[model samples]
Target: MGGSEKHAGLNNTKLTERLETAFPLLFASIGCIYLSVKIFNPHLKNKTKACIVIPTVDDLILFASHRAQIAQYRELEITVAGLAEASLFTSQKFYLNQNSHINKNLYTTVISFGDTKWNTQQKSKTSLRKYKINDERATHNYSIITKILKPRYKIVKETRNQKGKIKNPEYSYISIPISKELFCDNLTNGKPFYTDFYKLAVPNRDKSGKLKYRIKFEQKELNEMIEKINFDYEAEKIFIKACHTAWKHRLGKLGSDSKKPGASSFDKLVARDFERLRVALSKSKNFESFRETITDFWSRAGRIQELTDGWEKVMILLEPENWKRGRDLALLALVSYKPKNEKEETALKKLEFDDTKGEEDE
Candidate 1:
């Protein structure tokens, strides 16, 4: 009798423990049912903001993975928008190819501008409003949303100008904020796009080939690859470092380091080339003599209308003088149209001598 009682007590205790462990789960299941009914039944309205994200198709897929927890929130609704033209990769076709881990039932809308197709499109005027706002303020709010939601993978820079003006510069830098727990394993591996052992096992091309390099994956292969690329914090950090290095090389410096002289970058070479043109123009005597020559030619005998018609060409022929300002010479030349003979040239020379002689007498 004592043994029987002891065994019965042990069994009861185990049963109670199991029920206790399962109670929370049971309650959660009921709550989930209630929420689902409320969401689709048109009876319960969404209490939270309807998240409208504009993302290219590929980025939308990547963002969806990080949003698994958010999707679980019954109150939240996720909408992905894209433009048809700009977003070549992000489309219904591409999305269909990739199995979504977050909000599998999410909706995608493509916005078209004129005849052009865009990658992401949103019905809400929120983005338009943002663009109308002061750029700095708009970018700041956008960045905050991105950090919290990590939706569209847009980068916003908080920058200061030479005059100490603070501004937020927008960028298309791809970044996703993922939960630490979900990403930890991959984060240690330093590959954001590696999702599977097979993807890791795939051979990479070491040299150039006539055909482009591509990794062909079906549904099963894609599933594995997506998992491999999901990066954790450490992996993100490494990727960021690499991005920073590349950005530095591409856009960090404008010209050669000022400390190093005679070492020219592309920008420096361009500046030097422009300077040479300026010097050549400055030294050209054609410009200096332009006005005087035009005036003298007019005084001699040139048609004013003809001179006006061929002003530019005449100026070029009259070199040095074209550089001088005003159309005084050009005008006179055009008005005076008589062909100069040797006698006329001699008379003009004599008249010039007589004027000098008169000045001497004075």
Candidate 2:
């Protein structure tokens, strides 16, 4: 047999040269620090070669365009020092400057190394950090980058019966991406709702020392709501107001206290209201029936006057065809947390007292 010819592998030096040639703008913007720290350091330790995979020509073009677009934003800056300080090359944490323009496309490139999922066995070794961004101008795009992680089971082995049918399957823990829109919603009182949504939806350990999730949602539902809002400006406005209304009502129930509601209480409120809306929509045969259900819900919640005055538009969004979107929006609104203002506090105080008096009279 003829001997097979061995080809030389592309080492970090060659890879760096190739990257610098193909993506000059990216190379210049991130500088040698990113290339040395993020791309090559791990290879030196593990004796493994790391390479950027441009899956298609279209992807390469898109990435080049994104890098070019990011270069244009003079105000948009990433601190290479900060990246090193955070150990972002090895860690999952990525930091950006506060009050900076966060181009979504730019973010995809910067955090490209962070995988959406990892083996459950590696959970303890993984560290995720939260950094604050204070740009109201970039709220919409900022929300789009916040991720939601979901736990999934992967089949590793299957036991077959004598008949050649599978009897028992062994599964292993893995993480998967659910959606990005979990935190992609309107700001509350001019502040981003990303932190609040993270507390509510993301899985965390509880007092019992076990991982728990307050609520769960599907990607399709959030995508539907996002699509509707993005296409129709009026629908976007209505959705925002609906979210605000739900937050107001939730805070109002707190009775003017400075104390914030805990995640469990918040989850309970969202679940109760979501179930009510879901059931109501599922049973309604037409627009009129849906309207009646909404009217009844609002009336029972003591928001009849608000419904009559301004919520007609919100009602329009809950029609038969848009019921699912409406339900998802309501779910988002109920779970979303916003800081209470002085005016809202005073109103809540009055509402609480009025309700107490009504109960006494009854």
lDDT of each: 0.28, 0.36
Stretches of candidate 2 exceeding 4 Å from the true structure:
1-231, 246-297, 304-306, 309-312, 341-362
Q: Model 2, 267: alpha-carbon shift in Å?
A: 13
Root-mean-square deviation per candidate: 31.0, 16.7
The deviation in Å at residue 263 for candidate 2 is 21
TM-score of decoy 1: 0.16
lDDT of 2 by residue, 223-254 (tens): 33443333233553555455556445644563
TM-score (all chains, Cα) for each model:
0.16, 0.34
Q: Report how far residue 100 has shifted in candidate 1, in Å.
A: 17
